[model samples]
Target: MLTLTATPVLDVEPAIHGEGPTWDAARRELVWVDIDAGQVRRATVSPAGVVAEVGIHPGGGTVGFVVPSSDGGWLLGADGGFTHLSADGAATVLLALEGEGPAAGTRMNDGAVDPAGRVLGGTMALDETPGAGSLYRVDLDGSVHVVLRDLTISNGIEWTADGRTVYLADSGAAEIRAHDYDIATGEFGGSRVFLDLSSDDGPPDGLTMDDEDHVWVALWGAGQVRRYSPAGELVAVVRVGAANTSSCAFAGPGLDHLVISTSTQGLDEAARAAQPDAGRLFVVRPGVTGRPAGVYRGPVDALHRAE
Candidate 1:
């Protein structure tokens, strides 16, 4: 397998818990979330991995992920449900996943927009409670449906190039599963183990697929992002500076730059000192390019002003 190392982006500030890196092709920007800080970040990066500009928007509370909207607003998994951040800095709840508020101690976690423009988001308990999470799908018509359940930490959602296969990271289960996807109907069928990382490096966190259809998964606490072939073979490994590497995506004008997000959450002072680069962003070129992230096509105007 090939090996590479990532370098920190000096121009970017560190995040409390950074996750969900995505390349917005229409805006030609890199977007990610700082979950613990409830912030959505956007940046303009160059081919050589230099961050030129950044914009931060509030996500109500504890955002799981952020995706560009068909409208000028932003759609994200936050606090109790999916929220919309308007272009003018207004925030709205949009849709509540649970009841009026998040169930007792749970919050929305990582999520992504599927190829069919449907939003697939998940929820998890605050204390890492096992089997306390469920994945939810938001259709274009403003309807919500439960997709998968019995998950501990529901994270990382990505689809193959053809949009026929989905890879989901059940982080608390230490496994990533592949499911047959129906792009036309947005239904999932027969699931199988994609990568059993229970005996390997670390739990899979976020995922992205390259142009060649290989899946790249960020291994939380492993300080690495691994590239796996279509047949589930490890092809390359990108070493990161922080153990809490949360997520990654390919950005830049050509989509060839691999941008990674890290977290300092859960680390004590000593542990934070050991990984001084924790909570910072890193980048590396893996000699591969990724496709643009799926944009959310749901009804943006369905959002009501947050009370």
Candidate 2:
């Protein structure tokens, strides 16, 4: 068992709904989102680090996740669209989901790049209505395809190290579903419950897989992050300073450190006072390496087209 410590890396006023913590190894930085704030934030990490807030943006609308791109930038999931947000802070739309009509919620939510370098993101209804959500795959050719539907609060997505299995968490469902993944064809099969939290654990929020194939999940409203073996056995629990812990990732120069993102959204004055670091970013050296973040290899360059 590894001892966990919560170090406040970045202190911000408040994040309404923070999620999607990704490590950009090349730049030694950590990137995340504040959904209700409609912003994406980056913080630089150093050996004797004092986490500095590097950048922030309107994020088009309720940005949920941002991943490094093959072209040396980022792919940002915004309100019903995938956009290109460069390291220098310029933003451009790459794909739009306007055709989804009334079913279309406010914006996209949690997302991650598959081993094949394609972007896989899920959407949620702004109104928090049940079944008003969908998961999508954005191909390199700028095509967006709905891969799953009837989801409420689509969140916490990751793939196994071998790229043969996909783990998706539906917070509302209180279940983490696994699917046999095909990297060559980008298809998912053999869907079933890998871990069910409705009976014992809290709602699953964000997730990350370690080098040993263990799944680490953040439990929203439970104030903890749990590690589960590949076969769905609970291994460890890393407590957080807040109940609204949203997402987590392994970052730092060596990808051995775990960073968690929490939220203060919907918390009243007394509740906020109880958890003063609710929206702050926390880090822990878990003594385990994590898989590098997959890059967004989609049509991000099209954002730079000449007028």
Number of the top candidate by lDDT?
1
Instruction: Kindly give the stretch of ten consecutive residues in candidate 1 with the minimal lDDT sum.
Output: 298-307
| lDDT by residue (tens digit), candidate 2, 1-307 | 5436567654544567788889887667888989777788888765543466677866676687888888777888887768898878888877677643234545788999999888888887877667888888877776777788999888989999889999999988889999999898777888999999997657999999999999999998988888899999887888888888888898777677788899888899999889888888877777677876899877875532111
User: What is the model-wide C-alpha lDDT for candidate 2?
Assistant: 0.81
Best by TM-score: 1
Give Cα distance to truth, residue 61, candidate 1, Å: 1.7
- Superposed by TM-score, candidate 1 places the C-alpha of residue 293 at a distance from the truth, in angstroms, of 0.7
Deviation in Å, model 1, residue 67 alpha carbon: 0.7
lDDT (10s digit) by residue, model 1, range 139-192: 877778888888999999899878899999999999999999999878889999
RMSD in order of candidates: 2.5, 3.2
The residue pairs that clash in candidate 1, if any, are none
Candidate 1 lDDT score at position 222 = 94
